[model samples]
Target: MFCYQCEQTAGGHGCTKMGVCGKQPETSDLQDLLIYLSKAISMYAWRAAELGFRKEEIDRYVVEALFTTVTNVNFDSERIVNFIKKGYNILAEARALYEKAASDQGRQPHKIEVIDSWNPPQTYEEMLAESQGIGIAARLSQLGDDVTGLQELITYGLKGMAAYADHAAILGISDPEVYKFIHEALNFLTADEGRDADALTAMALKVGEVNLRVMEMLDEANTGTYGHPEPTVVRVTPKKGKAILVSGHDLKDLAILLEQTKDKGINIYTHGEMLPCLAYPELKKYPHLAGNYGGAWQDQKKEFDEFPGAILMTTNCIQKPAETYKARIFTTGLVAWPGVTHIADKDFTPVIEAALAEEGFTEDAPEKTITIGFGRNAVMSVAPTVIDAVKAGKIRHFFLVGGCDGAKSGRNYYTEFAQKVPDDCVILTLACGKYRFNKLEFGDIGGIPRLLDIGQCNDAYSAIKIAGALAEAFDCGVNDLPLSIILSWYEQKAVCILLTLLHLGIKNMKLGPTLPAFVSPAVLNVLVENFNIAPIKTADEDLAEILG
Candidate 1:
């Protein structure tokens, strides 16, 4: 097994034996094989699209398949093997379209031997045997590290884009061109033909360009479906009732669960990235949608153990379930745990029943609160006030210290950084990283809270828009504004966002807990030269550099 698509790759290099995130070597190999076949599917679609044959559903499926392999997402080797089989089936259909398009165009299609003429074995064991021949080692050796790294870079960026796009599509929103580029990009990585490093690098940036669009689509889907987020103080304390804890980033699932569990004498509590749901008008309206329960995804084993009810993970960022509550752990929407019950078709009947059967908080927990819901609409509504404060020197700087949170020890840089921000500065945080300092009181700059919770990592579009607005108001470039972006990355979603920042030419931003192992030194040089991106240092040192 070889994987290096995440921040915590082993020893700043690829994971050769097992994932640092507890993914077994078998699961890692299966994920590698899944991507290999998914590439085949994309290759066919790319050729077919050139001849005017296209399938939006196929394009969407490619993204979903890749996203499932993201770190700490799917640990169940059986499910991954099943997903690979599904990929081969999809590739079969895609190849037929490619062949037909070629015939109609009076051209013989290029015969890609492995993908074009391959047949799946009869059993899972045979599938694994076949997968061994096409895994990352075979592919990476052919391209070499620099070229392979660039391809993986582009592929991983697309994976992140697909994850965001999938979320938007769930809300019945999508963009055709985004899907088109996803297929085109995935196809670019499949064959040795036209795989120039510079061209691949350019395509990686293009993935960033499309990712901006995907994030915009997700922002629209989220706010449109749930109503614009408004400032709300969520109780950290749990109320007495039968309880269900909902984690991950799927608001649609949360919405459905809320509706199904309403007045059924069950209380729904947001966990980790789901914490921002409390700000959405439509979701928080249900009286049973109780307060947030945990800090971040990493704490779930402990937190879920303590929580006296069923836990539902609606999207990514799920850890492997412990045996203590493994039976009560439920997954949906691309998340899978080996022994956990999965809620397919958005049905929460089992989850609701589990909550009813378990003991909830026997009485209300101690009273505590955290303010969230400072999304674009809410933050931008007070734009004039913010601008005025900036001008008057009351708000001296803005810090966007956000991204995916992880278990890495160096991740404490974000906590120290956020804690050390000046009183006159405003900290804008999103995703699970904010769990580090979100509950701490930063006080307020006039009527504005000094700390702004800008929804999920999905709400990055909102942060970008707000930054553009701030730059416009100040009559300066985004990089020239008194803003410092310190991003903490864990997975592919953060990769796409970093590329987006580089695409915008937003220079001198800091990224940590560590640079990705997949980014070869050559690629890192390009980023450093072009965008001046830097790995974060100690909080005091980095803070001094930024403030200076």
Candidate 2:
């Protein structure tokens, strides 16, 4: 089982023995098989679309199927096997639809086929090739060295896109075109005939384009429902008493939990990507919504253990559970684990019970607050003043510094970069990367805080909206604005967001803690030459470069 779909793939290549993310070999193979089945469904769905099937039920399955394959989303082999069964069921339904269409048209309906064309190994040589990195690379090489590489990259990007799309759909926001693009892209990856370098490259860019749309739809869904984020200081200090630490990027889930536990004796502390929830008026209005409790996702094993209250993971970036805190943890939505109590659709009772059993802090702890909420709407509310400050030379630079946070030590660059940015420059950040410097007090440029914490990783949507608006206000292209995107990526969600930036022709962005191990040098060159993408240097160096 060879997999290289994430930033931390073993040795910057494929993970052959087991996943660095704690995925077993069997789990990895099932994920690959799951993706293979999803592609078959995609092909059927695409054909049905071509034949004028409008009310496509296959679209929902397509989204869920792709989402299920994302890193850290599903590590349970049992659940994955179940999803494979579900995918087969979906494929059967799609085949029936295709057949019915053909029958109505007096022609032979195209039969849905699952192609597991991988060569079966009989000899030691063949078995070795199938098991080693060289063999896996060869199969990927068949996708055409360049074409396969690009398709793999885009497939990872779509994984991220599907995650964001799934989140938006939960909020009753659905984009049919985004669904169409996903189906088309998934089919393209699996198609035997049209898989070529040029075609795959085009598909890759198109994934980025659709990801941009999904992010936009999510931005609209979030800000429209929760109100735009604004600058508000959120305390990092834990309050005295029992608390529930909510992690990951599900605002609706967080909102529901916040509502349920508001008057109870329990306190709600935001963790990891949930840090930005402090900006939402509805969420922040809850007096029991205490300050942030931990750092980024990668630090959870240590931080979660130290915390006294329960923890809820609404999404990904969860490492393997530590024994000390495993039972106190609860998972919701797409997140699942064998031992942890999972909060299902109708009931959060388990989470409440866990919180009650944990027995939070006995007395009131020290009170502290850290400001958050600077989403697009909140930022745009002061656009006129921001423009004035820029004109007045009070705000010298605008840094769109955000992305996923990871365990890599190089990530300290982000913390230092944000710290070293001129006090005159306002730093706009989203995702877990904001955890690095959100606590820093950079003061304000005019009325705007020097550091603005946007929403979750999906809230990159908010950053994009703010950038587009700033471009319009400044009467220039987004690239020509005073903004610089210094991003740090950990998982596939970052992949999709970066692709969206590329699709939009945003240039000179700095991507680091590390470049994705999946990106071949040739593909990296294509990005650098075309999009001016660069890796991050030291804070002093990058600061000079961006400000220069």
The TM-score, computed over Cα atoms with residue i paired to residue i, of candidate 2 is 0.93
Model 1, 414-464: lDDT tens digits are 888988999999999999999888988889989879899998899999899
Q: Which regions of candidate 2 deviate over 4 angstroms?
A: 54-57, 105-107, 111-138, 192-194
Give the TM-score (vs. native) of candidate 1: 0.96
- Per-model C-alpha lDDT, please? 0.86, 0.79
Which numbered prediction scores highest in lDDT against the true structure? Answer: 1
Model 2 agreement with the true structure over 1-548: per-residue lDDT tens digits: 88887777788777989988888877776666667667777776776666766345688877877787787777777776666666667776776776676677787866443433433333434333434433335567555456666877888888999998988898989977777778778877767534676676677788888898898888877877887776787788887878899988889999899877867789999888888788787778888887888888889999999888888999887778899999898888877776777777836777877888886877765776677787777888989999999999998889988988877568889989988888899888888888888777788866678888777788887788889999999999999998899998888888888888888999999999878776778888988999999998899998888877
Cα TM-score per model? 0.96, 0.93
User: Which 10 successive residues of model 1 have the least lDDT summed?
Assistant: 186-195
